[model samples]
Target: MPEYIHGGDVYSHAERYGSLPLDLSANINPFGIPERVRQAMHAAVEDCTRYPDPFCRAARQAIGRAEGVPPDWLYCGNGAADVLDRLAAVLHPQNALLTAPTFAEYERTLAGASITFHTLREEEDFALTERLLADLTPEREAVYLCNPNNPTGRTIAPALLDEIVRRCAQNGTWLIVDECFGDFLTDSAQHTLRAQLGTNPRLILLRAYTKMYAVPGVRFGWCMTSNTALIEALYRAGQPWNVSVIAQACAAAAAEETDFARQTALRIAAERQRLRQELSVRGMAVCAGEANFLLFRAQDTALDRKLAAHGVLIRSCANYRGLGAGWYRTAVKTGADSERLLQAIDEIREDG
Candidate 1:
């Protein structure tokens, strides 16, 4: 069997441990899919027999309008993972640089292309600095950056990201920023590099609908780049009907639901703050995560084992590249779920 990377491996573990618990491993929206989105999916059910639009024309247009980028500049995929794989196939860089303890998929995709990859250590709470960029090899072909990065939930400052983009462009290196969790940030537009897409031909911005709309099953995501040529290349490499008919309609509807998006942002902000305060009171060393999750270092491995035993699963980051034992990540769920998780952690602390 393949090595299990993160949480949600409950099925394999469930065989040994019995029924799976509430999965907090994946950084998904705790609110789940909205009622409007579910209704849209039911309405789209009749279109299943017809093949989904190869271009995802309506969906792409909606996303383009919402994001202020032209439809031609966007390339939709099964998920951001699909876009990353296609990117690897087309770019096939000989060397890539990524932050250690960031998203695992970037490394996994790079490995599949037989590329040499290096990681920048996350000393100082996984923060990125100008000095880190200075260490990149002149021969390096590309760099993968995850904003409000996974596991650690640390975001690169806007000024720093601008400097990195400028430096990468000057060095003739491709800079792919995976902002899948960017939506979780309060001022997403301020930190996002989307507006600078046309300024730097070497930049590729990846965005996803999974976490924001709570529709991972739909597998909708897109890559934004000013390089029309690169966008065309990715489009050609993508499989036809990569996104299902229902998914396309659902994605289109979700993109247009501005009110829903606003409400989600507010709810997440409040819940995240509440979770942070509660965890702090419990004495867990929590990181000030900007995303919809809080990353904390448990006092010991006993906390992780105890939480799982209570049927409340959270990500244990021991498997990540640079993280060690005691690292755990949990999503900001509904108020009730949050309370349940807090209760579970309290129990663990009491027992320990």
Candidate 2:
């Protein structure tokens, strides 16, 4: 079994490195938590003594209103990770299809249940293409996809996604689409299939406030599907008060920040382009993804360690399947933070 490693381990790294490093490993909003969300969480502290609404009614309602989906079609979880686990448990898929170099949690969760899964190769830019259709056979119970996928940060083309969904429906396969980073796209609406949730029974849209709202610790995530029975089943599979009061309050306010997503996309799009060019100029193989992050490769597989010496942290793609040594991922943060990372990379290049 391959080891499971994830980003955002600043605490442990800081302890060992003796300095608080700028973490570009986790792709989160550079602006940090919105002001309104901060105030909401502070107010929620007083109510922490009471149990949170297990159904997370208020937060779901806010999300539904914003997304134009019915509240009942939504199910909240401790985080997107929690929701993914619940979906695996409730569906109990005997076999599933996943794209290689994608999120590891899916394989990890399904593996625990002894479920079988197959991976599709992401060659030539790592984009999902028509080749996936041939792999979606009747034997597969489900298909998992990460829009603006982690590590690579590339999104599946909308037209291709439509074809995939239609094919999944034909195969009686559940299409689980994780849009956790969709908000980072400048043209997210065109890419998001949430509007089709009212009609597509096989489509499951997984989303979270963690990245967009900069509240990963709050652990807020929700899923939407037209299949009422499946939604109820997933909710039932979770523990009571799965979303705490603090999370609910913060998520609700964050959801209500109608302009936050737009501003974030605009900011990230510019930075991502600039970062990719700069990295390329430094002789790195930069994958210019549309999300708020970039995946690149240098001749140095030990770049992560070298960057840490400069009080910087980046995601090493060594553990991610389909990627090998010399690959790295970094979030497109604020200009200053990005400059720091670029400076560190420049230093590493000069040292070489």
Candidate 3:
């Protein structure tokens, strides 16, 4: 079988198409980087000769303030993926549980550590239910969950998720929630587990500025937990200076861009709804996700291929364990950009 793939690989597509394509595969903030963050990044170049602060104290402090947690409770990483890898390594679990049709990275990371994991099915539209609680047995060492889960972009309700966390704690299992896309929700605070960190030592909250700040190139993310020993273990397991000087500075500045996140969420919510409605009207089976992207099943054309032929790039979910051909995902871009994607679909349909 082929290896799991991730989105945002526009360079390879550009190479194949002989030109840059409209990249809708990565669910980034379509509003682009904040002006303040851009300036901070430009200023970061003045200090590249020195090694970055391996502890990431300043960045963590900013994030801590924004998240209302102590800086010592957090650990910085190259990205949320790096944190996931570190968690798997520190825990060294023999067995874990995850959801089907979720982020591919979890499987790859767990497998690398020789950790076996089971899967839970969404059944319809990837909706997670309380039945997930049954899988959190004492035998399982850990569980990986993504809030507003990837590809499908659906979020598990906070009450149910809290119950799951309690069960994991009771069963002596670690619950790692990847809230990478949580910032895109207007009511993210109500859904996030950040507040539970102090009470649930086994709870791991993973977050990233890559999507929310539109700074994927920066490769910055962090995790929070009350398990101070786990945080120390993650630090020792990672190389010194895993986060670059530029990334640290950018993240610190990005934290202060409060209005940026709020505005982006508003914009994405509008565009996502618009795209979902349009695709449904066109007879595509659309998943109305709560995040900044939409997933759909369409047979009108080889959606990914047809869109790519017209200089557009979207995610094909056939490789996802629970899904197959005809399933596609596209990021919620600005009105103009999303309209262009819709037009490409129309053009392909008309051509047939």
- Whole-model lDDT values for every prediction: 0.83, 0.87, 0.87
The order of the candidates by lDDT, greatest first, is 2, 3, 1
Can you tell me which runs of candidate 3 are displaced by over 4 Å? 1-4, 112-123
Each candidate: RMSD to true structure?
2.1, 1.9, 1.8
The residue-by-residue lDDT of candidate 3 on 1-352, one tens digit each, is 5643878888877889899899998888888889999999999999899999999988999999988999999999999889888987898777888788789888877874434434434455678877677777788888888898988888897789888988888998888899999989989888898878998899999999999889999999999999999999999896888999999999899888778888889988988888899989888898869999898888854789888889999998888877789988899989999889989988988988
Q: Give per-residue lDDT, candidate 1, residue 98.
A: 79
Considering TM-score, which of the candidate structures 1 and 2 is the better prediction for this target?
A: 2
TM of each candidate vs. truth: 0.93, 0.96, 0.96
lDDT of 1 by residue, 1-352 (tens): 8777866666855876888787787778876787778898999999998998998899889999999998988888988999999998889887888778788888888874434434545456667666666656667789998997887778888898988888888888899999999887877777789889888888999999899888877888889998989988987885787888888888888888776656677788899899989988988788878888888877777666787888888888888887778888998878888888999988877876
Q: In model 2, what is the error at residue 133, expressed in angstroms? A: 0.8
Q: How many Å off is the CA of 260 in candidate 1?
A: 2.2
Highest-lDDT candidate: 2
Error of 1 at 346 (Å): 1.9
lDDT of 2: 0.87
Candidate 2 residue pairs that clash: none
Separately for all candidates shown, the number of backbone clashes (residues 3 or more apart, or on different chains) is 0, 0, 0
